[model samples]
Target: MSKKETKIYKNVWKPGTEDAAKKFGFIRPEDIIRKNVQKKPTSKIDQILTGWGNYVKSHFVELSPELKAESQKRLEICDPCNMRDRGTCSTGRQGAHVVTGKLMKGCGCRLAAKALSPGSVCPLGKW
Candidate 1:
């Protein structure tokens, strides 16, 4: 009896995925594939509470000029980050600070409020 060999397929992209990705202006077809990569789930309740707390602290409370400056610096770093989608840190996205190469996780917080809050820390450790 001979042992059978199993063929393993790699880089198996789904049908029409590349086309749809192109239609949406994705620069690389691989970017679409990367989005489907599974990541460990972050706590939604924790994210929600943290976001709310930061929002309240940043908005209702007074911040020093130093804190405001710090927020500006953080925003500058976040502006070009791949994990930042719209205004929020995109949860479960991979990659890191584009320049620094540190590993990243999405905290699911609004960047503006999160930066302004004195106690808030970045999921990517940018700040």
Candidate 2:
């Protein structure tokens, strides 16, 4: 095979895990293994309030053309991000600060609604 025809495969799971399971006569089911295992106490009230406020403003208030353009730009950034999962942001995956060069994670927000909110900010500082 030529260099141009070569393919590389990413090792996504633990080495020999599937083989070990098979040795034990078990069939492994396919699923997304989340890296963020330690659950933290997030402020439910604050999250709810922010989500509600964004919804109301985006749906009820008229957005200027510039604001709409900005929203679209934000969505474009979110579309191909690995941190996005099932139309929502996935937390705990490593990202970087746009300005400070600091490590960060997703904020766990619905992308469609968040993209429309003028006050909503990307956890990765993409916008």
Off by over 4 Å in 1: 1-62, 97-103
| Model 1 lDDT tens row, 3-83 | 221111112224555554355444354655666675445465555565567567767787567877887899999899888
TM-scores for every candidate against the unseen true structure: 0.47, 0.50
RMSD of each: 18.4, 18.1
Error of 2 at 21 (Å): 78
Q: What global local distance difference test value does model 1 have?
A: 0.67
- lDDT by residue (1-127, candidate 2, tens digit) is 2343232112323455655544543433432233244445446455546556765777878767886788789889999998898888888687888888898888888887777666667877787
Worst 10 residues of 2 by lDDT: 4-13
Lowest summed lDDT window (length 10), candidate 1: 1-10
Angstrom error of the Cα, residue 42, model 1: value is: 18
Residue 86 accuracy (lDDT) in model 2: 88
